[model samples]
Target chain A: MSDLADLYRDVVLDHARTPHGFGLRDGAAAESHQLNPTCGDEVTVRLHLGPEGAIEGISWEGHGCAISQSSASILADLAPGDSPEQLRSRIAGFRAMMRSRGEVEGDEALLGDAVVFQSASRYVARVKCAMLAWVAVEDALLKLG
Target chain B: MSSIAPTIAAATALEESEVYRLREDFPILREQMGGHPLVYLDSAATAQRPVQVLDAEREFLTHLNAAVHRGAHTLAAEATEVFEQARETVAGFIGARPDEVVWTSNATEALNLVAYALSNASAGRGGPEADRFRLGPGDEIVATEMEHHANLIPWQELAARTGATLRIIHLDDEGALRLGEAAEVIGERTRLVAFAHVSNVLGTVNPVEHLVSLAHAAGALVVLDACQSAPHRPLEVKALGVDFAAFSGHKMLGPNGIGVLYGRAELLNALPPFLTGGSMITTVTLERAEFLPAPQRFEAGTQKVSQAIALAEAVRYLQRVGLERIEARESQLAVRLHSGVASLPGIRVLGPGLGVERAGLVSVVVDGVHAHDVGQYLDDAGIAVRVGHHCAQPLHRRYGVTATTRASTYLYTTEAEVDAFLERLAGVRGFFGAAS
Candidate 1:
């Protein structure tokens, strides 16, 4: 029960109930449709880039498990106003943490509330669910540069 | 690793007491997961292979390892004898002649062989008799909305290539195909009717006899995806009256990389070959070649030699246990599983409702919890089940849910395991705090 609680923290449940930037946005610079074929979880991410090569805004919409949906909601909060390079570093850090298999602690200062997903790394099958939204963010970010 | 665990006693000595004994034959079932006895409820995905199958493959490889057919050595002759004997055994199991069975990589390839052959016939590839298999713009290929992607996609591609129309028989709220609309869906222009004998997700045993009759009356051929049925009960292709049927070896306590395609003798000889290569050919030239007949024509490259031998051993194992008894045990387990799960709060069993008989499986969708969460919850408690669209996206769409958690039974599955599955499942909604 403690492990389940750690994986499904209150913050994740709250984000799942009311997500940020969940609808489509017009005039976005790039868009991507990502699907986790195993569970039929899908997400469409749209990003708006400013003239300085910075992320001006981001939006998304999808349906899946709380892990995937909450991850997308968290990404909506974390991905905006950051340069593509910054987003790449965060994605790389998140990937490393997930691959650690509970060996490495998630850096709270860098990942913020997203660090709550560290417990999800123990489940090999659910790791993809946590990464689905970040993958879309990566693709959308690449289109900006 | 330091201590050996004591063996648990067999659960019951009922009419199907052999099922309890059968559990000891599968070594993996004895292992523990997460400090609890492993409860395997996902046999529909792929069943665990018994020791007889494993030993059969090993023994063959250790003593007689040679390519079958077209060899002069003694080992080759011995291997060929064993291979041909396996074909004969498989034929007897399905009530077909050895000449009527064609071996392939898996059920997916078996189905694609038939679809591609029809496509070839449409392109004027086969000889005169193949005209019975060709199709064009006005022709329609009818399948049900509940077909697995393997059965549905090939026909879709065939239609795309041959300018044919693809129609489907829709499912009702219970996930059963609406056979009431069979006549309207399958008209004179319908060239082929393809469907599953038993749905992998819904567990609904389709009315194959009735559907075959309708297709025959319309002058259309019938193809049955027996992937889910062949392993669960006694099957005779002649009695079913279908032109073709397909099943995978891995789903029936056999090794992987082997499958069987059963076609009526005359129909097989008439259809064009889907693959062409060494063993399937009679005489070869730079220009054109003469092809072998029926089963040989479809088997292109080197076959899964040891896997086929292991599959034959699996057939023998099933025979020894008696499929009728196996079927009865599974039916009782499925009824208990369905009723127990359905009785839980906020649980919706997909497919058939209460008092309705289905195959030995049950799929469920919780009210507010996703299937993935339910699966993880179950997995954490030492129970393994299948959670996904289960390769039937269109069928999932029809049911208005993207995914489901399915628990399936087999000959080795026990009543206590079903109870554990239900007990673990009963707490999922409460675990997720889903309103009941």
Candidate 2:
């Protein structure tokens, strides 16, 4: 493993171990059920959009293998105050990162530890597993709009 | 590294020298995947064809390029000779009379012929055999939880068409069939007992003679799905005493669009044809069409002649190795593969463990990693394996998993391939950070 990969693995482990918001949002703005049919991973993400239409709080609850659960945790931690436009770019950046197409050119600092999984892109099949939670978040945000 | 092919060495020592040499015949095994030699562990889906089979096909299309049983010309005679010769080869390979074999698009169609015949009987369209196959209220069709969809669903459809009931033999935690319970279920009501000889997913080898005995005692016809077994084992359908047997050519180093259905001559002569068209008719009038004998009555429309010729060559190749030797060689490889995968931490095998009863597969769940991820990791490493339910969802449910990664083997597989797969699997969970 490269030095950068080692650093990334640590970041993923940290977010996976201690997620930000992982319960049902008491008064959420939008929610959706997400399933990775390929791997049988399922998650339900609920979001709370603020009065100004920015992501206020997001949380999730689901059951799956570790990669999916950890990906969900990272998504929960990163959703706090971003507008819809910013999150769309994040989704695109995440797609590119997972594909290992180019450098992860988004605001890597704001990826808030979710960036660790960026190195996991090499294993093409697990990208869907690692992206399960983020997909659910993106879906919920689209529905919230 | 001694550069010794340990898998081949073990096979060569197993009284099957010819089978060991079959490795040199397949061209795909020499190709590289991810810069490493491709370790093809997915033969259960389809076996790689050898040069002889491919060349035979090319020769047939190049030289004997005409329709069979037609024209009364030399090309017609040559084409017909090639087609019938292939049939005789396949029939002899399985110890069935050549007249008993019927060709179809694939095994599913072959089985559907039997199932639909019974269905026609229940509807009162079947003739003298109607009483033999007719199933209505109180009649039963028995199978097991480990059946591939091709074997299971046909019976299910049969039961729904008639008022006949469908009963299943259950599998234990390790995926072996509960044969003792099967003895009780296959009673007088059973009109057909259909199942796979080797499960496509679990890789557990069922007791054919035992199962056939129970079905026969009840006066029921037995249908064996030899899709998984035929390619790996030395099978004598007559010895097994099955009334009908179905298998595909594609999975056994033959061409696609060709399959076999072998029936007891007496039973086939009695049943009605499920498909009726041009070549299958004995004679035709504006009022009705009289169908031909057993084999012809079932093979409707144009046939997979070239593909059938290729399949016959495949049988010849397997015969050169000797089926008994092939069975022994594969069983040893299966055990080594099982031990290798089973020893990996947190991995749970989905079928009968060890040498007690297994064919050529190992379906497994890595403790915390999803099957697709394991598949991808192995794919990245250039080691191809099957992932997901393996089209045996109910079997997966019985094992308490929605999906699993299956590493299947064949005559051409080597120990180094198994080692490559195992090494990559050991590092998989850690690669995805699921390793606790």
Candidate 3:
């Protein structure tokens, strides 16, 4: 269906193939490992903070479906240069979009490439896949706090 | 090595027309998925219920609904008689005495019952009667790497509680159990051997008789996880010489919330009850309560009465169709399933290789495409399959993968359905741009 195309857009596929900040890095402020027990997908996200506690870098490594891998890559791409508060707001926005169940169009300004997951939100099972990395990053931020 | 006589001689595969006719019995087959006819190939997860099973449950609830074994009224008498008859039917289906069959919520609970009962016995709950079931330091429990978590975790807990070591019978690269390792592992100190008759993920049927002989020689009890085999093949627990077995009803075209646990009558009567309350005891005082015999001792609280009746009807349906014929038909599908997927480039079929006589299911790993993506593509095409660790995380780890796409078949599964699944699966890699 067209919705399937929407879920796996060209940008998402590109990110999944060659994800940004794909490897776990050293000298991080905090790191968190999250597993999606339903499908055995997992991710370990490392967060790097600037001197003023702004988000400097986010790196992650994991194995999972395209949705999860691409979502992680997109999160890593958008998380830089934002404060922990800004990143938390982004996380909340992405979570709200996922929970919308196709009813709400995501804010492209806030979610950026992550808005492509709006189609994935229609699939109840795949919502977790899109959120796996975001949850890991959230956990990492909590650890930093 | 089975002592029970075969129900039928070797038979030819069911005709395509006959399979089509049988498919009519499942109303869900008529439903459409993603604007296409539903091609159900996930029977290993849970088989679609036939009309007979649905009617059996509704019929019982409409006419014979009553609390069984407690009331003395006419309705209660009728309900109890029907309930016991259902037990007899299930018992006969598995080649066990009626008294040896215990009703559980599902196979998980059934396995837990035995595990917790043994733990209770080890804690001196059943006194000297359950001495044979007790395990302490120096005792061992053996399980295989390919077991579903339901069968594996209970034994892990059992060993953790009793201080008995938990050993594993590793699998070969082909996904079959290594009987040599099993022989070495199941030695004198082994108190119990727990394994699945067929791997839920790999679909490789384990060597029941060989493992049974090994456990028997070690003077250890055998607990067979028959969840995968009982629905596809003729399972004679007594003939297999297993001391205990567990299987779910939903996987066999029966209703959910009902499962059967088969144990030797003497062994069941001796073990302490896991869930103690009303309907399972002989008498009770403020401080202590005496439990009843075998099946009743294990059945506590309100039972899944209607579900059990429906499961019996499901068993009767299988019997009437003849398990040998179903088995024969499924074997042909298994070959087709294995070869069809194996022939595809970059597709690695798990479990037995081509011509290796696996059960009627095939799980495969598409080289570059993740199983979830493959599963989603197939789902869009209205082809249902199971994709994940399939509750055997260790087996997946052994294979060096996190998940796999599994297509399983049953009596109602047609050749066209299997082909449809494969055709959709063949396109998954190309769609995902992972075609190598």
Best by DockQ: 3
Q: Can you tell me the DockQ of model 1?
A: 0.76
Query: Per-residue lDDT of A69-97 in model 2, one digit per residue for the tens?
Result: 77788777677788977776777777777
lDDT of 3 at B364: 91
What is the TM-score (0 to 1) of chain A in model 2? 0.82
Q: Which candidate model has the greater lDDT, 1 or 2?
A: 1
Model 1: per-residue Cα lDDT over B275-316, one tens digit each:
998898889989998889988999888988888899999988
The candidate with the higher DockQ, 1 or 2, is 1
Off by over 4 Å in 2: A1-145, B1-20, B285-287
Give the Cα lDDT of each candidate. Answer: 0.87, 0.81, 0.91
DockQ of each: 0.76, 0.28, 0.85
Relative to the unseen true structure, what is the C-alpha lDDT of residue B67 in candidate 3, on a scale of 0 to 100? 99
Worst 10 residues of 1 chain B by lDDT: B1-10
Q: For candidate 3, what is the DockQ-based docking class?
A: high
Error of 1 at B128 (Å): 1.4
lDDT of 3 at A9: 93
